[model samples]
Target: MNHSPDTGTFQVIHAYTRAEAIGDGVLVDVTDTAREAGYLLPVAMTSAAWAEAVAWDETNRALQDEAGRLWDVLWMARPAAARTGFGQTRIAFDVLRVPNHPAATEPHRVTLHVHIGPGDDGHAVLTVLLAHED
Candidate 1:
């Protein structure tokens, strides 16, 4: 079926929200940490980004910490967010991340995309997702 964009007519179906994603582990809310890092808006990371950049276990404790890793991700995002646009909706950024792979010996470049959009309640929010993710 073809739907017109101008027509304010649409059927309510399955609506997955940011809150629900965080609650369901699909998205990890990092707004607190972001604020600590000097961010003014709410921020979140996709499950994939969390797994690759934020997840830390005792196995990797000797080499890295979750806080440091998370900080690195946010640190890189800072300049990228600013360099691209002042108030753009979408921005693509890259960060060097030490993957959670046991075989990984060095940091690899990972592309992360940031989308600034309306929150569940109409507030501005940011969602960081893997390059291939929506």
Candidate 2:
């Protein structure tokens, strides 16, 4: 994805109540509109910050992806009770830091930490952090 340049310094911001999912079996209903909010960060940062942000994003993606896979496995293991009715789930993410750069004078990289869990209302919630580094 590409980011526009900005003059402000970038910082990690929390993306509360981002993605969502519901349903059972292999046919899970998922939505990722929350991911779009992450791009709102600044667009330039220091080299160190940029590297850190990139690392954070990489780690975050891996963790979230793995969690999703695990969820799939769990769903498949269930017989019927867990498959019928509505199964609640959630995912959360946290942004680490923002990078700085002289060329852009803002942070362009964004890092996110994601978590998935079951919601109280028989639904799934996804938590995610959106950070931008320059």
Candidate 3:
């Protein structure tokens, strides 16, 4: 993605990479003007912090990609409900092996929440809450 050299804060993530990471099922406009696909990290996140978040033992890009694939499966399974109103679902990911932290030895549970609702136009909006566990 060619992140900015400054690894302190405000690392510039290419919009295309983010979009590809999310998947090709939906189109996201990431331009400054559109801002439809804005990347909103937790308020306290600096570039270094973001790096740590991605490099964490339990949760990382691979897990996120798995969750996205799972979401596609979930969407296909709810075709009947999707015809009328909103359909929401969630799945838990048991952080495998390697424990959750550098010291801890037990696995932790991370949940991915999916919200499928009607979009502004004729399309649909698929919102995935990547960090919601409960």
TM-scores for candidates 1 onward, in order: 0.84, 0.21, 0.27
- lDDT computed for candidate 2: 0.29
Which candidate tops lDDT? 1
**Could you say which candidate leads in TM-score?**
1
Query: Per-residue lDDT for 49-132 in model 2, tens only?
Result: 223333233333234232343233223223221222344321223232333233332333233323233444435433322234
Winner on lDDT between 1 and 3 is: 1
Using alpha carbons, what is the TM-score of model 3? 0.27
Residue runs of model 1 more than 4 Å from their true location after superposition: 1-8, 83-87
- How would you encode candidate 3's per-residue C-alpha lDDT over 1-134 as one tens digit per residue? 45555674465464443245335523322222212223221111112212222224444323443233333323332342234343333322222322224565443443333344433443444433344322
Clashing residue pairs in candidate 3, if any?
none
Rank order (by TM-score, best first): 1, 3, 2
How far residue 35's Cα lies from its native spot in candidate 1, in Å, is: 0.2
Worst 10 residues of 2 by lDDT: 18-27
Candidate 3 lowest-lDDT run of ten: 41-50
